[model samples]
Target: MENAKSKIKLGIYGIGLLMMGVIGISSSLSTIGAKFPEASQTMIQNLISIPCIVIIPTTIVVGKLMQTISKKNIALAGIIIFLIGGSAPAFMTSFTTILVMRGILGVGIGICQVVSTAIVADNFSGVEQQKVQGTLQASQMAGAAIMVFAGGWLTEVRWNYVFFVHLLAIISLILVAVMVPNTKPEKMTTTGDVQKTKLTSATWGWVIFMFILFISVQVYSISLSFLVTEKNLGTAADSGLGLAFFAIGGIIMGLLYGSLAKRTKNCAIAVGCLMLAVAYVVIAFAGSMIVCHIGSILVGMAVSAALPGIFINTGMSVDGFSAGMAISVVTCAQNFGQFCCPYIINPISASISGGRSVNFMCFIIGAVVAAALTILMLVWGVKKNRQVI
Candidate 1:
């Protein structure tokens, strides 16, 4: 029993490490921008977001592959790819080469991200499952916090050194290889019948919810530097501090998610959306670094609260056989929203302000949309609860 517990703990940690791959380059954005003066700002920003373009499709492929492949093996292979793609950019000379490598890193992230959540749904159920899911999110946020801080420090030495952060995947690779069991695909149910999997309407609802919510929240990461600099509030390095605070807020909310979910029950997403609205309002009007940091933290908390709620609902809405695919679909929606954030939000922000750059006005727009989402989530939650009753 003790041995099994240890393995479960290790598996959770491995998933956390895998999640660190998503934002590994976030802190390096400023340094990369300085290095490539010839590149357009949009192009420089793409270096951080280009991976999501790949992650979207890769997640779907990984979901299909999970039907026959051992998750442990997939995780190991993904980490190997993650290490290579994540670290290779440090040594590359060409901007195109770096962009390609970032996409390679996305493929790796796509593989493991689906597997990580599926493993939890496959092994646990009920409150225990909720607890583990919260832990999984907390661990991911904690790992991201550490990486953001470390990556920022590394950038002080050289722009390329930030890529070295990918080497940490080696530890995750070892953990998954040794500690995570090679659970076979659930081709057959316990009754010796072929298990059929299909996504329900509720599952699709959560997917859409996650996509819309992420579109608003992602502006925080993609626009932090611009918001700070445009206001003359701080330098590029200071944006890292705001990002760190964002992660710190996520870590706190993630740790509390199980309890929060229990208390909020059907209304969890509504509460999260409301929090997000308030957070954006705070950020939109900030005049000092301290206010900006508070806003960043609130944004983190809002996301942690809302996203895990979506993941947990999506996982519970499907059977064991469909868990991975359901998660992959939701993840694809989430990533697609993130990838389209600049395109969608920027145009609207530009039209409203008659400017091309994203600014505090973007956050104001986010706040208004988030407030509307809060009402939508409340109505949906009530309808869902009535159906359950």
Candidate 2:
């Protein structure tokens, strides 16, 4: 049957979405200090954060280019670059060269980020589209978990071996080539009643909301190390364990996202934010690594559930042609939040806590702010649901 065949094709196409999340193999380098003892701490930190700088501009540029080029081609090109930049450093000893390669890797990730989301919007519609959106976020969280958890062990062999994890991008490249449809951007019609792609104020609202939401959510990872050291909770390995729990939470949340969304009448995001607020409160008062691990799991669940809602809402808020551009804007905002969480949260936390136990104070502040936002979001959801009824 044609319908049965279409379902098979959709299943294959979905695999491409999973590949987007795997390139995050870079996050597993927290233990680089053991391998690069000669480098200063600041320079070592740059090795991780510097790639984020290139990811933003490169994402926005690729979003614009999709109009004039094949989306499949752009994604394929990005994967090649990602593979080269991500894996080449494994063979080199120079810190400077590795950093350069990481920057290039960031560019490749930036391109894929935009293309991956756009690919979903292009292929599916309605509820099916939303399900795929959630799956994509789940895949990303799983990918990060895989890289960080596995990369941690691989680092025990040699830090350079961790860089080889980027080679996984090759699998994604093949999926994109064979599974994703090779089609040009949608052509605009010249006749009357052609739907002009105009993003409404609602679309912009989602973008700003995502920016602020990401700013709050990403703080957990940015502040984790300090939280561990200031509290004398445990070793770097313990912190790594906390991250693994976070990923597990995300995977669980992603699996239940569809059913939760239906039961909540689309208030799933509000509920997820409330959970994040509670998790932060728990972390603020955590006295043991066990407590912190619990908090990390909650943080992961909250982020995983909340992000897909934003992506699905953003997709629905715009036309197909504008979806790429709109989604790109929000994606840029999300990355920008990752880039700025430390600079923004550190001073605020220090001033609030008078520099003693800054991480705890930041968590407390994050909890209060997220709680307030949750109330507003819940109220909005109730009203919208009522109108639909």
Candidate 3:
């Protein structure tokens, strides 16, 4: 407990939380606006997908940067760059250019996100490390939660102003680096450990888990903004409420999921991912605005519960270079989903809905993927008759 309360340690977790906020902010804005009202849902889906396309390779730089510099330095550079890239839209006139800027923003997010868990391990150890991870994740979720309100308030002022809110998190990053003490990275003991503990097929399973995991959660995020405009459900302000549900679902899961995992013998994760798949189906098929809203909460919960399972399991399975690389791979998958979903889902939903099927189709795909993965996993599990703890 004393370790958890360490002021220096909180600073480290603060960096991770702020990076998550930068990650969450982009999706919030993509969906919440009316300027793109005439765009097909397919176009929105493309919007999400496009940035992800850019992000996959950019993570190479994140890996290289972490190799040469302190993780704190890597994070600091990302925060500074994200602050600029994220805030750029407020002053820019063209939405097309805004898309370009978002891709740049993805680069920063991709790197920082890939390095987030490593930073915890880099700075803290044992129970302090675990506690810091929990808090950092909570902070990230809280950041997502607050972004809804942030988006609402900022969009109320000016849509572009939403970028400025990212600066607050950047400030948090600056504070953490300055306040936290610098320590040499733990020495790598053996090439043997690296070879022995590398990510295996099972580890890749979790990597896939994080990928679909983010999509399931982000489906609500990017969709919320557009769903409002499409359904003629209130104003842009209402969009934030959906994301609020997303964050709330995540927070609730993050808070209680560990206990749930303990009691259910980690059933929360298995159930959570399955719920994510179903939530996608619910979102895709939802007819009424209220139903969509309820679906959003479920999607959020699934995301929240499932992430811890993925993290804990993945962390146990992978180590050293393999861990770092796997972290990059999974995180890249997340941003890619965020980047791609807007592009893929938006247009599909807008189309199926008769005008902009992007939202509908995207969620359906997300749902389908989640469901498919779960079913295949179950088949594999049953065939092997294996039980996971």
Candidate 4:
């Protein structure tokens, strides 16, 4: 492929937009829920699931279609879907309509998530691939930081104004659609020496990792309009700033990730997961709502470091695996966690105490997850290094 442009630059701007679009979908709902006291937290969580429900099957269908379709065609399809999804607030009423639009948004995000990364990977090789991926992730965190904060503020002024975040993605899509080269897949691996891993390992690991990560996300990522109003966390805009801090933590983690990984390969991911687990517990056990915000920032940091590692590792592990599957499983797991948290809490609240009791459980579960991940990563790392059990 021609050295058409700097892959790092391409990745940052491309993913910055895609990530902005993806996070915008969730944040719009969540941030709106944050400002408005009318909706229940459980209901808000349910809305988050709307997109995930649609994305599971859509991912596979899109993956298969990627083989034949022009990247331009697929991306255009994704953007149109995004525009529809983004316009939901402008067009729809009632919670149900919001959910329907969210599902459409999910399809767009799912398609672009996989396809965009694949385009970068297709164009770049070796160290450049790693750098580009890292840059893309950092850009994503940066976008989330800005967009979520903006969403929160917009919710206060006028909720529909938040929809404009999707417009930001247009630059990324247009650039990628026109400027990025469509190179044929080479027969050889981009990074040398590492054996092409099997589909079985890749698929199984992707699913497992996705589920694990989302478990923590349940407590971390909240559409907690209930809590926001209940606790009086300044204003809706201030609330988004809190979320932005979390994303900023993630950006810091991503920027530092390459150095972290060089030490133990999966060092960043392993530690990231461990931190997430701890953060989840902290969030669950939080007495004041402020603790929840702290936990969110910590969780975002872990997610920033861990998720890209999982995607890269999965991409490397399975030669035939679709990027759509990679994006799908991770996102589905995330949304699953978001869905399950409230569902679990609803039933538990009735049985135990009210919401407070459930929060404690969230913390306890997070602790257990951290311990499990710490053990798993260390064991895996040791084995990879050929150290004895």
- TM-score versus the correct structure, for each prediction: 0.94, 0.86, 0.81, 0.82
Question: What's the lDDT for residue 222 in model 3?
Answer: 60
Name model 4 segments beyond 4 Å from true: 1-12, 20-40, 183-198, 223-225, 281-294, 320-341, 344-364, 387-389
Model 2 lDDT, residue 291, Cα: 95
Cα error, residue 323 of model 3, in Å, equals: 1.7
Against the true structure, candidate 3 reaches a TM-score of 0.81
Q: How do these models rank on lDDT, best leading?
A: 1, 2, 4, 3
Best by lDDT: 1
Task: Please identify which of the two predictions, 2 or 3, would achieve the higher lDDT against the true structure.
Answer: 2
TM-score, candidate number 2: 0.86
Off by more than 4 A, model 1 = 189-196, 354-357, 385-389
Residue 243 CA error for candidate 4 (Å)?
A: 1.3
- Cα lDDT of model 3 by residue, 275-345, tens digit: 88877777666676677667777876777666655655556666654566666666666666566555555
Model 2, position 219, has a per-residue lDDT of 64
- What tens digits encode model 2's per-residue C-alpha lDDT throughout 80-185? 8888987898899888898899888878878877887787777776766667666666766676666556655566677677776676676776766776667787
What lDDT does the true structure give each of the candidates? 0.80, 0.72, 0.62, 0.63
Q: Order of all candidates by TM-score, from best down to worst?
A: 1, 2, 4, 3
lDDT of 1 at 375: 99
Model 3 accuracy (lDDT, Cα): 0.62
For 1-389, candidate 4 gives per-residue lDDT tens digits of 34466643563356455553545534455556655568776666655566655665665666556556655567667777876786665555566777777778878866776666666555555666666666677777777787777777776677778766666666666766666555433334566543332355656676676776666555545433334444454555655666777788778877777776676675567787788777766655555557767876787788777776777766666555344445545555555554465566446544654555444554565557766877787677667656422
